[model samples]
Target: MNAAEIARDVSARRVSAAEVTAATLARVQAVDGDVGAYLTLLGEIARSSAARVDERIAAGEHLALAGVPIALKDNMCLEGARTTCASKILEHWIAPYTATAVARLLEAGAIPIGKANCDEFAMGSSCENSALGVTRNPYDLARVPGGSSGGSAAAVAAGEAAIGLGSDTGGSIREPAAFCNLVGFKPTYGRVSRYGLIAFASSLDQIGPLARSVEDAALAYDIMAGYDPMDATSLDRPVERTADSLRADLAGLRVGIVREFDTKALGERSDALYREAYRDLERLGAELVDVSLPTADYGLATYYLIAPAECSSNLARFDGVRYGLRVEGADVRAMYDNTRAAGFGPEVKRRILIGTHALSSGYYDAYYVRAQKARTLIARDFERAFAQCDLIACPAASCPAFVFAAKSDPYSMYLMDYYTIPMSLAGLPALSVPCGWTVPEGGNLPLPIGLQLCAPLFGEKLLLGAAAAYERATNHALAHPAQIGTVPA
Candidate 1:
C-alpha cells in the first residue's frame, strides 16, 4: 500500500499502526535473507515508533505520514542507530545525531522499519559492490537491484516497506527504482540537505524517496525535503510548497525527447522500450518534440571524473583516525594504509585510486578541471532545451536490470548510468516512473522499464504531475511481483 492509503486507514481506525509495522518486519525477515535489502532491522524500535504514532492519532493529532512504515538507506544518519552504508568499515558505528531528513520523517509520524543496504560509501552502480553482499532484484532473484540505493528500491518492490529513503549521487536512486519497478524521485541538488548523509559525491548527492506509486513518492518528498540551516548548499525555498503548486493539466506542457538518447548506446531491448514509451505518451494527449543536448555525449566520462574526484576528498576522512574501521600500526600512516586496504571493498578502493589520480596536482587541470567546464556546458544544454520545452522525457537507463553475474568490467557496468547522470551534474529535478515491462521468452526475465521525466530546478510539481498522470494511465505501480505482498509482512 502507498503511504497515503496507510495513513488514511490508520486515521480511520481500520488498522493499528503496530499491526502494519509488525507485518512489515515479518516481511523483511522472510525475504531479506535472500534479497539482502536491509543492513539493520530495528524490530523493537520500529514497533515502538509505530505504537507512538497510533497513540498520537488516537489523541486527535494530525500528521501527514502517520503510521506509514518506511526504511532508511544505511548511509543516512539516525540518532543512536547504526548507519553503516553497508560497509564493514563502519560495522561498529552508530550516529550520535539524526539526519535532518530522518528527523523530519519521524516528526511527521513515519515509522522507520530498518536501515536498507547500499554500495559502500554509495560508490558503485550495482549493489554487488556492497560489503554486505548483493541485493537481489525482486523481479528476478538471479539479477541485481541497481545501486547504491538498490536495497531501498528492493525493499519497496518486495513490499517490505511502504516507502524508502535513498541518496542519489549519479543514478543511485533512479536506476534502482527502475530495476525494481518503483517510482524514484530525485529533487534538484541542494533541495534536500546533505548534512548527515554519508557523503559520496558531495555536490551530486541528494536524499529522495522511493515508493510504489508516484503520488506516494511525492508525499514523502514533501515531508523530507526543505532547506536546512546545517547544510551550506541547502536552498532557502520551500520544497513542499513548490511540489504542491504543480498543475495537474498537461495541456500546454512541452515534453522534449532528447533525440540523442534514443540510440544504439541504450541497446536494442532498451531502445525499443523507449520507443514504445514515447508512442504511449503520444496517445495520452501529450505533444512530443525532438531536442538535442550534444555535449551529453560525454556524460559518462565527465561524471566518472567529477564524482570520484569529489568522493576522494570527502572519503579521506575515514582513514583509521576517524569514525570508520581502525587498524593499529606503529604510526598513524601505516594504520591509515592498513585500515583502508582492509576496510574498503575493491570497488571503493578502485574509485579512490582513480579519483586521487585525476585530482593530483599535475593532472587536475586536464582531467578534473576540464570535466567541470564540460559539466557547465552540459547544464547549459539542458537550460537551452528547457527554454524550448517545459519538461524532458527519456529512458531512465540504457538497459533494464542485467544478470548480476554478467557484470565484470567496471567501465561497462558504469555505462548503465550514462543516461541519468548528466541531470545529476546539472542539479535538476528528475524522476523515474515505470512505463511498462518486457516479458522475454525462455529467460524468466520479466524486466520493468522506466520513463524518465526531468524539469527545471525545483520543478518537482510538474514532474510529479506528469508522473501521476502517466501512472494512472499505466497502472504499473499497483502491479505486484508474484508471491510477494503482505503474505507475512
Candidate 2:
C-alpha cells in the first residue's frame, strides 16, 4: 500500500502500526542484502515508534501518517539512528537530535524504517561514492539506482519503504527517482526546512521525497513544507494542503517545452518517450508552447563552483577536535589534515579541492563570484521562460539508469546532472515522474526513464496539480515496454 492508503487503513483501525512496521522490517530484511538500500536499520526504533502511534490512535487521535513506513536519506538526522551521510567522517556517530523534518514525520505517526545509504557527503551523482555500501537499482541489480539518493529510491522501489526522504542538490533526488521508476519531488528552496540535514550546499540542497506516486510525494511535501525556527532558510509562510487540491486536468494551463533542451539528441528511444510525455500533457489540456533558457548551458559549471564552495565552507566544521572520525597528529594543524585525508572519499576530496580553490583569495571573484552571477542569470532565464509559459518540461536526465562503472571519468559523471541542475539553480519546485522504460542494446531488463516537470517559485500547487493529471492520464510506469530481447521489456 502507498502512504495515503496505509495511513487511512491504520487510522481507521483496519490495520495496526505494529503490523505495518513489522512487515516493512521483514521486507527490508528479505531484500536489503541484495539491494543494499539501507545503510543502517532502525527496526528497534521503528517498533517503539509504531507502538506509540497505535496508542495515540487508540486514544482517538487521527494521524496524518499513521503506520506509514519511511526511509530517510542518511544525511538527515534521527536521534537513535547513526546519521552517516555514507561517509567515514561520521561513520558511526549517533545523531544528537532528530531533524525537524523527521520530528514532524514522527508527530504525524510515520515510522522510521532505517537510514538509507547515499554518496559520501551527498557529493556524487551515483551511489558508488559511498564509503559504507553500494545501493543497486531494484529493477536490475547490475545497474545503479542513480545517486546520491539511490538508496532512498531503491528502498521505495524495492518495497522496503512506502516513501523515502532524499536530499536534492542538483537532481540527487529526481535522478534516482527516474532511475528507480518512482516519483521524486524537490520543493522550492526553503519550502522545506533544512534543520538537522547535514549540509551539502546551503543554497542548493532541499529535502524532499522519492515516492511511488505524485499524491504520495505531495502528501509528504504538504506535511514537510512550513516554517521552522530551527532553519533560518525555512520560509515563514503558511502552506496549503496540496494532496486534496490536486487539479483534475491541465485546463487553462501553459506548459513550456524548452528550445535548447533537445531530447532528440539523447537518441531515438529517449526522444520518442519524452515527446509522448509532452503529448500526454497536451492531451490533458495543457497548451504546449516553446520557451528558452539561454543560460541553462552554464548550469553545470555554475553548480560545480557554487555547490563545492558552499560544501567547502560547510564542511570546515569537521575538524579533529570535534565529532566523527578523527586521526591523531603531532599537532593541531597536522591532526586536521590527517583526519580529513583519512575520512573523506576521493569524490569528496575532489570537490573540496575545487571548492577551496574557487573560494581562495586569488580566484574568489574570478570563479566563485562569477559562478554566483551565472546562477542569477540562470534563475532569470527561468523567470523569462515562466513569463511565456506557466511551467517548463524537460528530460529529467540525459538517459535512464546506467550500468555501474559506466561513467568512470569525473567530467562524464558530471554530465549526468546536465538536465537537472538548472531547475535547482533557479530554486524552483520540480519533479521527475516515471514516463517510460528503455532497454539499452545489450541490456536485458528495461530501465526506467523520467519526464521532468518544473514550476515557478512557490508554485508547487500548480506543479503537482498538473503532474497528478498527467500521471493519471498516462500511468506510463505501470505498463512495461514490448519485448526487446528475451524477456518482455
Candidate 3:
C-alpha cells in the first residue's frame, strides 16, 4: 500500500500500525539479503513507534503518516542508531540526536524501518562505493540500483517500505529513483532543513523522498519540509502542502523541453521513452515550449568542483581528534593521515584529493572560483527558462540501470548524472517519475526510464501536481520489480 492508503487503513482501524510494521520488517528480512538496501534495521524501534501511532489513533488523534513504514538514507541521524553514511570511517558511530526531517516524520507517525545503505558519505553514482554493501537493483540483481541513495530507492521499489528519504547533492536521489523505478524529489536548497543530516557538499545537498507513487513522495516531502531554527539555511517561508496541491488536469501549464539536451546522446530506448512522455504531456493539456540552458553544458564540471570542495570542508570534522575512527601513529599529523587513509574508501579518497587540489592556494582561482561563476550562470539559465514555462522536462538519466561493473572508471560513472546535475547547481526543485520501461538489447527484463520535471525555486507544488497528473494518466508508478513478489508473506 502507498503511504496514504496505509495511513487511512490504520486510522480507520482496519489494520493496526503494529501489524503493518511487522509485515514491513518481515518483507525486509525475506528479501534484503538479495537487495542489500539497509545498513541498519530498527525492528524494535519500528514496532514501538507503530504502537505509539496506534495509541494516537485510538485516542482520536489523526496522524498524517499513521502506520506507513519508511527508510532513511544512512546519512540522516536518528538518535541511538548507527548513521554511517555507509562508510567504515564512522562504522561504529551512533547518532546522538535525530535529524529535524526524521523527527518530523516520526512526529507524523511514520515508522522508520532502518537506515538505508548509500555510497560512502553519499559520494558515488553507484551504491558499490558503500563500505557496508552494494545495493542491487530489484529489476535485475546483476545491475546497479543507482546511488548514493540507491538503497532508499531500492527499498521503496521493492516494497520493503512505503517511502524512503534520500539526500540529493548531484542526482543522488533522482538517478537512483530512475534506476529503481520510483518517484524521487529534490526540493529547493533551503526548503528543507539540513540539520542532523551529515553534510556532503553543504551547498548542493538537499534531503528529499523516494517513493513508489507521486502522492506518497509528496506526503513525505510535506512532513519533512519547513523552517528549523537549528538549520540556518532552512527557509523561513510558510510550508506548502504538496499532497493537497495535486491536480489531475494540466490545462494552461506550459512544460519546457530543454533544447540543450541532445536526444542522440541518450540510449535509443531511453530517447524514445522521453519523446513519448512529451507527447503524453501534450495530450494531457500541457503546452510544450522549447527552452535552452546554455550554461547547463558546464553543469557536470561545475558540480564536481563545487561539491567536492564543500565535501572536503564538511568531512574535515571526521578527523581523528574529535570522533570516528582514530588510528595511532608516531605523531598527530601521521595519525590524521593514517586514520583517513584507512577509513575512507577509494572513491572518497579520490574526491578528497581532487577537492583539496581545487581549493589549494594557486589552483583556487583557476578551478574553485571559476566553478562558482559557472554555477551563477547555471542558475541564471534556469531563471530564464522558468520565465518561458511552468516546468522543464527531460530524461532523468541518459540510460536506464546498468549492470554492475559496467563502468569501472570514475569519470565514466560520473557521466550518469549528465541529465540531473544542472538543477542541483541551480538549487531548483526537481522530481523524477517513471515514464516508461525499456528492454535493453540483451536484457531479458525491462528496466524503468524516468522523466524529470524541474521547477523554479520553491515550486514543489507545481512540480508535484504535474507529476501526479502524469502518474494518474499513465499508472507507470504502479509497475513493480519482479522481485517484489518474492518477499515472504
Per-residue C-alpha lDDT of model 2 across residues 1-489, encoded as one tens digit per residue: 789989999999999999999988988877888889999999899999999999999999989989999999999999867988999999989999989888888899999999999999888777999999988888888888899899999998888888999999999999999998889999999999999999989999999999989999998888888999999999998787889878789989999999999988999999999999999899889999999999999999999999999999999998967779889899989999999999999999999999999999899999999999999999999999999999899999888888899999998989999999999999999999999988887788888899899999999998888899988988876776311111110
Between which residue pairs do clashes occur in model 2?
Answer: none
Per-residue CA lDDT of model 1 for 1-489, tens digit only, reads 778888788878788888888888888888888877888888888988988999999998888888888989999999889888888888779998999988998888899998998888887777888887668888888788898899898888887888989999888889999888989999999988888998988889999999988878888888778889999899998655533544444666778999787655666766677777776666677788888999998888999999989989988988887696898888888899899888888888888988999999899999999999999999999999998888899988767787775678998888888878989999999999998777644456578878889999888888898887777777765565632433232
Q: Where is model 3 more than 4 Å wrong at Cα?
A: 484-489
Candidate 2, residue 1: how far the Cα is off, in Å: 1.6
The TM-score measured for candidate 2 stands at 0.98
Distance from true location, Cα of 152 in model 1, Å: 0.4
lDDT, candidate 3, 1-489, per-residue tens:
788999889989999999999999988988899998998999989999999999999999989999999999999999999889888889999999999999999999999999999999999888989998888999888889998899998888787998999999999999999998889999999888999999989998999999888999999899989999999999999978899899897999999999989776786777778898999999999999999999998999999999899888888887888768999899998999999999999999888889999999999999999999999999999999989999999988878899888888998999999889999999999989999988887788888889999999989999999999998999775555455464332
Model 1 TM-score is 0.96
Error of 3 at 219 (Å): 0.7
Candidate 1: 10-residue stretch with minimal lDDT = 480-489
Instruction: Work out the TM-score per prediction.
Output: 0.96, 0.98, 0.98
RMSD of 2: 2.6
lDDT of each: 0.84, 0.91, 0.90
Q: Give the 10-residue window scoring lowest on summed lDDT in candidate 2.
A: 480-489
lDDT at position 333, candidate 1 = 86
RMSD (Å) per prediction? 1.8, 2.6, 1.2
